[model samples]
Target: MSEKRALPWLDSPPDGFLEREQRIKSQKQVNIDVYGILRTKDVPQISFEVVGSTGNIYRTIIGNVPFCDCPDVRFRKVQCKHMCFVLSAMDVPSELRYQRSFLPSELREMLATLSLKRKLDTTTPTTAGEKKPVDGECPICFNDFKPKQKTTWCQDCGSNFHQGCFEKWRAAIQTSDNAVRCLYCKLPWKGDEPETPRPTPKAVEPEQRRSKMKYPNVGDN
Candidate 1:
């Protein structure tokens, strides 16, 4: 399973406390569910007031870019869950959905779907008989010219990396940072189907193994 990084916004305080305070002062408290939070979009602003079952209301602000009236945000300049929750509620763009809560299996499936969607979305208009090659070079290693080789290219941007190069690059990137996107480029490989995690062998039952064993059949023959 890939070790997912906590989104900066989820761990740090939101930005601009005074500005957030003004915004929160105008809005009312809202209810959010877990899944609902994931689907929300980025809005102009979001404010969270935690009354803690008690009457004491603690209010904080989160924006698309995020601003909060909390000291942590002002001093440390980081995003807090309040910001993440608000952003999720706002249905922020995928680029901004910083938190990754999906399990490895779920992430793999998501990536597979994303890969397919990318392919379909990027398919150029062409006749059935004609296969046209889009031209582009790798921005990282610059192994651009593989004139005679049939290579798998990125469906989103027509960037082509040699299959061998891609494999080597991915292997080298396996340990740089836990689940950090490859330093060579922004491409993420940590989520690749985790090598079927090697199974731990259990102790064999002696009686069952002895009973099931097959002896030479020469005597019966």
Candidate 2:
């Protein structure tokens, strides 16, 4: 849980980074999940769109080298989470994916799986009362709770926080005895498996995705 929004890069290794940096990057990559990554439609390929941990979307472009629009990527010029996502979607083996060259792809099969599955299915939260957490608003970030985003709950106080905000709060108390206390109640909070946001009222994934995906293979283009 790190509250540092202007935070340092997690799993990103700088260009020509050393072995120690590589090891550290690999370890942190585990904590970050690739939400969704799509191959852009421009000629010779342009970039990939990735849904980030904070429930925001970012762009990852493969140029003379790999790059992401996130602050960490721009400032550090390292293989940030968004690039990790782009590489992961390409099905590049873990060892190869770290290199900038491997981030770009001509593989359509891999692209298909990620096309519309935006957002990580990390955790769904309980909102207290009868309404589902997704139905109510989050206590922090002030954004409406979305089923697609990772969410957390406090059983004691029945308050819910988005995953990013939850981790941010947890970071704030790291120096104190209560690491994961409820911000509202100061009660220690327990961790639980996260739930994905429920499908929207229409719930039309299977039919829609299949219809939209018309290309037969990478060679088709």
Candidate 3:
């Protein structure tokens, strides 16, 4: 009888595994964006369409057996940048990111967290003019603002949020009217005015210019 393959998640990762994963994450050039997320009804698996740095789209699955179709994973048999992007974007913990498998309960918790975030993203804030202290977690991502991180303040409410998080929140709640409003105060965002094309200057006719002149030039005769 053939022996069963051991689960990778059960064993400790190889030496330098974490350092290598960190290196991949720190690479800004390996840009990635999630196109969409798919969840299986019967299976505990979740799939993501991740756009990679080279503009190629790859399928990444997180569940009993984590998988990524990127060349780095298929050939090297190691975690790839696309996998790192998906996990990091979802704010998955560092300990779980390296795991090759996840329990059903873990997947459920992740999905629940994501669902709550989506709800928060789409729901407009009703409370207006209530200024939240600058030190708390951002209402959008629910993450604490780090020092030196780019940030923006609500003009009316005086609430502060990470600039990137605020932008995402603004985008999610944008209306057909093209109005950008403060997330907390629900008032029109002062500095985020929509760009309008500058009006073209009208040309003045020579006759009109001459008519308006207080004194006619002698050379005009």
Candidate 4:
């Protein structure tokens, strides 16, 4: 939802703006590029690398105006898809909606609160579905999991994959209408929870997996 209050350098979009933004999002016309988010010690404005259908990275900045350096936004001077995506995802508070840009310090403060949460949650017991560590094996490759690599899991079939292997499987998928399906279940990624829990493959040495987790550089979002 676009608010009425405008930022210092931004103006309220013209009529039909929200409708147009929703249309583009529904059509999936824009792509959030790999290595898209750029934050540095140099500039205050965070840069986002967004790609259009043509796969060309567009220069977009997250500041007061949250601008896209596309000809459509440059020449036509309208709200572009890139700006819409960030604003929608960021969940800017109503009271803080008109800020020029969010500072790294602000994000660091929020992180501090999360750090406190980790300590508090240490003694708290969790359920099997939450923070349930899988085994040190890549289901896709059926190989030993490498350290400092990204991984994602299929909640439906309870299968995990190294992010690279997952991408390869997803890329090689030949499905009707090119749908995004779970590699293990061969079902659409989006679905309601099953009434009966499906049998999950046993993760080899599941409890013996290391707890010393270290995040690696995200190759893509």
Q: Lowest summed lDDT over 10 consecutive residues: which window, candidate 1?
A: 212-221
lDDT of each candidate versus the true structure: 0.35, 0.44, 0.53, 0.45
- Worst lDDT 10-window in candidate 2: 212-221
Supply candidate 4's per-residue lDDT for 171. Answer: 32
What is the Cα-based TM-score of model 4?
0.37
Cα deviation at 157, candidate 3, in Å, is 14
> What is the TM-score of each predicted model, taking all chains together?
0.23, 0.31, 0.49, 0.37
Q: Which residue runs does candidate 4 get wrong by more than 4 Å?
A: 1-13, 29-43, 93-221
Candidate 1 lDDT, tens digit per residue, 45-156?
A: 3344322111122344432233544434566665444444344334344454444233233333433442343254235554333323635433222223457754544432
Candidate 1: stretches off by over 4 Å: 1-136, 177-221
Give the clashing residue pairs of candidate 3, or none. Answer: none
lDDT of 1 at 11: 44
Tell me model 3's lDDT, rounded to 2 decimals: 0.53
The predicted structure with the larger TM-score, 2 or 4, is: 4
Q: Report how far residue 216 has shifted in candidate 2, in Å.
A: 34
Candidate 4's error at 115, in angstroms? 13
**TM-score top scorer:** 3
Candidate maximizing lDDT: 3
**Per-residue alpha-carbon lDDT of model 4 for 154-194, expressed as tens digits?**
55554556666555444323111255565445557532333
Backbone-clash count (model 1): 15
Predicted structure 1: lDDT: 0.35
User: For residues 1-221, what per-residue lDDT tens digits would candidate 2 score against the true structure?
Assistant: 32222223336545644553344334322111232334444213336543344333355664435677666767766667656645554444555456555222333433544433221222343444322345454443334567688877666545666776566444323312234555444556654536344334345532332212321111101
